[model samples]
Target: MSPDTRIHRARVLALSLGGLMALAVAVYMTLGAVGSWSFVLSYRGEKLLTILLVAWAVPVSTVLFHVISRNQILTPSIMGFDALFMLIQTLAVFLIGAATVTQWPPVLVFLGELTAMVAFSTLLFRWLFGRIAQSLELLLLVGIIFGVLFRSVAGLLQRLIDPGEFLVLQDRLFASFSGADPQVLAMSAALVAAASLWAIWRLPAIDAMILGRDGALAVGVPHRRMTAEVFLIVTLLVAAATALVGPITFFGLLVANLAYRLLPGAPLRLTLPLAGLLGALLLVGAQVVLERVLGFTGTVGMVIEFLGGLLFILLLIERAR
Candidate 1:
């Protein structure tokens, strides 16, 4: 197909995805409203906001991560952020006791998690990107190693903690849309917005970086600096979302690859926005189905993980082939 035709088709697909996302939001907010409008609005509004924030954060982080790593299958969670988040939560409970951790202010807990994630990612990425000669293979290997290390430590800590505390930590380890705190919601929105703005400003650099490191360098892009900047932005986005709703292993891969297929050959500007919309659509739509059709028998995260795992395996198979 011609370039113009491809762009036109991409635009149409993006608009269609946006429209469906809007429909999903409407259904989520107004489908089963028997209570007072104000009450329903206030209640569902908080959940919707959390969903939207996560929707934006996850796909953006995933896409930027893919660009930097040049691997469509890799995501922020794969870099050990999710494991690190769990470890931090487990440590908090282990050190302070479950009762104290639960009694602590949500804002304080959120801030502590966010700060720890940012600090950890900053140190990790600096070492990976700055000192390692910018090898993608090295970065991936180190990330996987750190992920295993974090999970092992968390497992040991969980084993040593009281059973009740372990249960509390286990509850917090999985993602949940229903338990999203309003305080964390506000903080996450601000962080996601900041990261979005930075990504927007660097769209040109990102486009160049998509050409790979050597090509970007040949075309005057400062590959090292741009890669670091992308990593920082990805860290903040992933950290905020993970803190808000816990770790989601395959949701990023699902929405990001869907965006790529839906908008084939599209640039980052189009693909990024479309990916965010698709993320929201998939998340909110899944929530709607779980609530309305499945009676909320399971958490949305569980369903997403199941589907995402299948997709991950399929992609691996395809890559091998």
Candidate 2:
């Protein structure tokens, strides 16, 4: 297809995504009308807002990450952020007790975890990117190793805790849109807005990155500097989103690859927005089915993980061949 044709097709698909997202929102709000309109609107509205935030944060992080890594299979979760966040939660319950943590204000708890993950990511990325900014291999390798270590440590601690405490901890074992914190949501909105602007400004360097480090440098892109900047952006967005909605292991993988297939050879400018719309639609639509249609038979996160894992394996086999 000609370049003009490709761009036109991308725009058409994007509009389709928006239309579906609007339909999903309509169903989510009105499908289960019951008692008070005020109560229903206030309650469901928060959940919708949380879903929208994750919709933006997760796909944007994953797509921008693809720009740097030049691969569609790997996700930001590979950085060990999910495991690290779980460890933080496990440690808090093990030492301080879940009941106490639960009693504390949700906003404070959210802020605390968000701060820890962001701070650790900053230090970790600064150290890693300093020496091996050009070596995506080493970065991913270390991340896998740390993920194992963190999960092992958290698991060991969990075993020692009481059964009641373990049950309490299970709420966080999967991602949930319920209990969306108002303060954290506002803060996350600001962070995502700022990150989006910075990412837009770096689009040229990001586009060049698909040419690989040497080619980017040849094209006047500061490959190493841009790589570091891109990773920092990924870390910020992923950490904030994970802290907000627990850990989402494979949702990004699902939405991102779908966006790639939907807009083949499209620019990041087109692909990223399309991915975000797909994310929002899938999330809201899935939530509707789970609650209204399926009667909450399963959590949204697990469903996404199962489907994404299948896709992950298919991609792996394709690459192996």
| lDDT, candidates in the order shown | 0.89, 0.87
Expressed as tens digits, the lDDT of each residue in 14-129 for candidate 1 is 77887898899999999988869998989999999998889889988999999988889999888899999989998999999999988988888889889998998888777876
Model 2: residue 311 alpha-carbon error in angstroms? 0.8
For residue 1, give model 2's deviation from the true position in Å: 3.5
- Relative to the true structure, candidate 2 reaches a TM of 0.96
Residue 184, candidate 1: alpha-carbon lDDT: 81
Q: Residue 92 deviation, candidate 1, in Å?
A: 1.6
Candidate 1 clash pair list: none
In model 1, the runs with Cα more than 4 Å from the true position are none
